[model samples]
Target chain A: MSELWAASALSVRIAAVATLVTVLFGVPLAWAMARRKFPGRGILEAIILMPVVLPPTVVGYALLMLFGANGWIGRYLGGYSIAFRLEGAVLAAVVVALPMLYLPAKAGFAAVERELEDVATLMGANRWQTFWHVSVPLARRGLLSGIVLAFARALGEFGATVMVFGWQPGRVTLPISVYAQFEQGDLNTALPTVLVMAIAALGLVLVYNALASQRD
Target chain B: MKHALIRLVVLSAVLLGVPTARADSIRVGAAVSLKEAFGEIATLYKADTGETVEFVFGSSGQVAAQIKSGAPMDAFVSAAKKQFDDLVKDGLLDVETRHLVAGNELVLIVPAAAVKGGAVGGFDDLKKDAVAKIAVGEPKTVPAGQYAAQTLKALKLDDAVKGKIVFGANVRQVLAYVERGEVQAGIVYRTDAKESGDKVTIVATADAATHEAIIYPAAVLSKTEHGDAAGHFLDYLMSEKAVAVMRAKGFSIPTDPAPAAPAKPATP
Candidate 1:
């Protein structure tokens, strides 16, 4: 039972950190794609959205090769091994959850009325000021729902996390814990961990649905 | 929409029915560690008999669990005796058909770069702060990991290296971790370590007395529909041709007489 709690807490921690990262980068990228016109825009958008269509295992394997100890980026970050650690699991979740957040956030940024932003700019507000004061407030509801969906998806991540982190018990999240339990032939333990994850995911979706309906 | 749905259902039905339509094949569940050897043996069996032998490879414990859950397997080749014995006790396997196939040795490995000139002594060196992480398969579910744990405990290094251990799903993953230099060292089968080419070098071989014998056993499942075909495959697995393949892959073919033990089935 305590093991389950530890796993649940670890799951929440990884998902929360992943959701924060998704918002930090995803919102800005989605904003640029939505409001700006540039060469290679389609290609950039396709690249960002690739994770949504690609199998999670492929994404996991690619991340492993990119961030593994001898990996291109990892080799330079010497002494700070990311693979087989909690940070790797968090990174896997962020990569897997990025598209879920970005797609909806992109649509929200596109739906924001251009007139409101124009009015803000006309009133002497800088572009950055306009973005925060007018654009973001209007798109808050969609972005919030996107965050929730990304959090739920990150919490349920398995293939990529396992591929990158290899199911270290102390650092393992809920889905990996469930898989480990199943592999160890303890379905009794796996079922409850699965239930806890399912209920938490259901609750997150419910909150998102509420926020989405309230937006109307 | 309804017409498309009907077409989709028919398409899926035909796709799912294709495998069962060809009933001449036999499905064998084997440990992932036996993949290279069994793959060659499978090819040889096909060439000689013109019969198809499909394989499902995974950790021995997982394969055992699948067999217990009534997986469509005609034969099971496991890397550990416990899983095979458990199945035999459960009456899921034909006890009379069980035979020792091969054995393996466990060894400690380090990345080639880490071993500059001298090897890192033995189990005690694994405790040095410089050796941050050590990869092993999940001990409870993988036979190789079980052997590693047993060896560690025997050497009294289990407590010393507790926190530094990172578990993989199977032996191959452990080798990958070492090959990629993710961990300073790892414990895996001698065969696996040998196959890792220039990426890793053996530091020490674990004493066989430290752990249960690393044995491979093969048997026919009681629920097999194709009994004669399954029996023939079992015989083929013990044939000289198969033994040669196993030997080439570094498996030590057992030459000892079968042990006499209580043959009572589990009272489930």
Candidate 2:
């Protein structure tokens, strides 16, 4: 079934874009969390970790309420409806994968020697340049880990995706396709997509391992 | 390991990325409930016409969404008229080619061994002490689940079995849950029980009067490239050979007008 391939392609696009979104939002937040003690910092950390602890179905239900047709946000964005569309799938992936990116990034940033950023600052590097040129390179392993892990998690996102995006053309991701085929009692038909995902996930883990060990 | 991954990528690219539809084949999006019956029908259809009818099976609601979003299905066979009618309103179906493929009866099923002692007899018996959990498809998307809810409500037993109901995503899932003995019983089409062989027992058949009439409506898609082939496939669904296969699989020819769903919902 071509559905399998379409789903695979959809999954990749959703995850890749989702990871980019996660990095955009998560990395800055990770830096703040790692370096600054803000008001209600504990609450922020709890919310960031909640996704990993919550049942995916509950997360899906919560998202459906926030992004469904009748949801306030959805109603306001009628012309740009995210529900039952590719954007909704990417949003779900981004939401679920955010913490996967944030935790590693925070740890990576924290592990970066403060002295390096201080040295860069002393050597006439501006705050932005020092943070980007010094802190980023030093935290490379953790950042790479987060990206790969986030991408993998995003690629496999399903419950929230099916709840918000629903299963339709331009939106059916790999997991949903596999569910549809298996629901039909067609295991043979579901196998190729399953294999693709399995191999892809394995490859990501290897990539993460290689990156983790590169310095050693 | 790297080579293996590379080969898998290329193999899947060749096998799944490219279009699987041939000029002579018509891509059909069908309800998953037809998996067994249509598998047999497709075989007979291919033998008779030498045309491959590639079926993409899912819940009726799912198939409707696919048709709405333009999944390139040449035809559709919906489990009920609501989905079919929805497609009609969306201007996705070739209304002239629509036909009633069969009428199905909703039945109560249990693990084959559970009823060996006749512990459960009917819908009312689902509330019995021995039955702890009953599986039904989620009524929102799965048509059989909606029908099951209606059947229980008509029998004034919905309230009694409400707490113990375990919602499966689809009828096959409900059947599987019952077969695995994960649930004491399930409500599904009689055809499911037929395919299940000895894995599950048909404990009781719901009376037709208790719920909306179950119907399967088949139609060619409006945007089909192989319109002629799709129309012929619809015709084949009505042919004697296809009917025989359907009948053998426990589907009954409907006496009602084709596409006129006998439910309170508007007929397709």
For residues A130-199, write the lDDT of model 1, one tens digit per residue.
Answer: 9888888888887888999999999999888888877665656788888888888888868888889888
Q: Every model's DockQ, to 2 decimals?
A: 0.70, 0.02
Q: All candidates' TM-scores?
A: 0.93, 0.54
Docking class of 2: incorrect
Candidate 2 lDDT, tens digit per residue, B56-142?
887887787778877878999888878888888887887878888888999999888677767688888887987767878767567
- RMSD, every candidate, angstroms: 2.6, 15.9
Please report, in order, the local distance difference test score of every candidate based on alpha carbons: 0.86, 0.81
**Alpha-carbon shift of residue A10 in model 2 (angstroms):** 30
Q: Can you list the residue pairs that collide in candidate 2?
A: none
